[model samples]
Target: MANKYKCINEFVVDSYDENEQVEENDFFIVEVGSIWELQDESYLSDVRLMDNEGRWLEIAQSHLVEDFVKLN
Candidate 1:
């Protein structure tokens, strides 16, 4: 089964700004209390989190231990 987690601290997620048409890093914050699911366990992996509107967002593995707590 996939492990579930809850965001305990706000963290930044790097994303691309399609409108800007640049390769530079664009960031956004994942608020505390957001729930996430472990997606890939490999190094530099990702986690999936659902937004308020029911859309899923992918978060980098770097924030896993730093900002989230395992739920199950």
Candidate 2:
């Protein structure tokens, strides 16, 4: 199993499409849900984060800028 992460800040996801002229990546917010960081053995790269909206983003861990909170 892998560790899960929740987006604390708004970030951009570069989602490619058939259109060659699109210059912007998709924007994601905290409400979108948590992102998951899978282990190295997984077929996907170790740095990829899985978004709650089902979008897989390949981003550096440092760029994520995440924080964890304790729950009661």
Candidate 3:
């Protein structure tokens, strides 16, 4: 399919707001698949969430970058 890549999964990075607008500096949990991309392998993302709009972002780190394997 020529548009196979275009069918990639999409997500709306929306921050938890009750009465006000949320900024990008605000932290949030990306709820999607069971597996999540951790920042520097510390179970977090360097970038944060913001606004009521869909600020969707995809995270992918190469395994060669660092050994983020959790030790038992």
Candidate 4:
């Protein structure tokens, strides 16, 4: 069983390279109303989520504050 979430706020994330380094000029925005599924929650600061595209992303827990609502 997986928990789903709906985005309530738009947020931007930097693109990372194969080495996991942030690309200075590359970023993407997660628009409001996007839905994501919880992938992993073992990390203390961030949780992994799978977007509609099936891409897994790890975002800061703080960013989720007031930004998403869980849908069980």
Candidate 5:
């Protein structure tokens, strides 16, 4: 089978008010420098970085808009 995963070019982490909070699977927008470069888009679920193990860490969000991505 062909590749089924691609990394997104953007991963942003936002904060709520002093009395609010963020939730899991929070909907957000992500832009990529090159969709072709990233062969896996699902990997960008939360767009966060992880530790040596399997976890989600915070990644800087991207603001670029130059391409579109499709399922392969």
Candidate 6:
């Protein structure tokens, strides 16, 4: 079973290139899941978000702070 969530805040995410470099054109808003993988370090760990497309993203804890929530 997967968790569910929604975007409470708007932020931009950048993608990486073949050389592991950040691409400016890859910048996008996080329309991913509100449901996330729980972390032991809530404030110091990166949260995992599963998008509507079944893609998973590991974002910094700061990025998701007060921006995402876990569904029952």
lDDT values, one for every candidate? 0.62, 0.48, 0.32, 0.75, 0.34, 0.57
Error of 2 at 11 (Å): 1.2
Candidate 2 residues 1-72, lDDT tens each? 457666555555556344422337554443334555543542322365554456555555555545321122
> What digit string (tens of lDDT, one per residue) describes model 1 on residues 1-72?
767778898877654343423236656677788876655533224655555544345556676678888886
Best by TM-score: 4
User: Over all chains combined, what TM-score does candidate 4 have?
Assistant: 0.73
* Residue 51 lDDT (model 1): 52
TM-score of 3: 0.20
Candidate 4 residue pairs that clash? none
The TM-score of candidate 2 is: 0.48
Candidate 5 lDDT tens digits, 12-70: 54533323355655544333432322222323342333222233333323422212233
Q: In candidate 6, which residue pairs clash?
A: 4-35, 5-34, 5-35, 6-34
When summed lDDT is taken over every stretch of 10 residues in candidate 1, the lowest stretch is: 14-23
Arrange candidates, best lDDT first. Answer: 4, 1, 6, 2, 5, 3
Candidate 2 weakest lDDT stretch, 10 residues: 63-72
What tens digits encode model 6's per-residue C-alpha lDDT throughout 8-41? 7766766645454567777656654444444333
Q: Give the per-residue lDDT digits (tens) of candidate 3, residues 1-72.
A: 111111123343435345435555675553322232322222234322221344323333342123223212
Best by lDDT: 4
RMSD to native for every prediction? 4.8, 5.5, 11.9, 2.5, 10.0, 4.8
Name model 6 segments beyond 4 Å from true: 17-21, 31-45
Instruction: State how far residue 6 of model 1 sits from its true place (Å).
Output: 0.5
TM-score of each: 0.55, 0.48, 0.20, 0.73, 0.19, 0.53
lDDT-wise, the better of 1 and 5 is 1
Candidate 1's displacement at residue 57, Å, is 7.0
- Assess the local accuracy of residue 20 in candidate 5 as a C-alpha lDDT between 0 and 100: 36
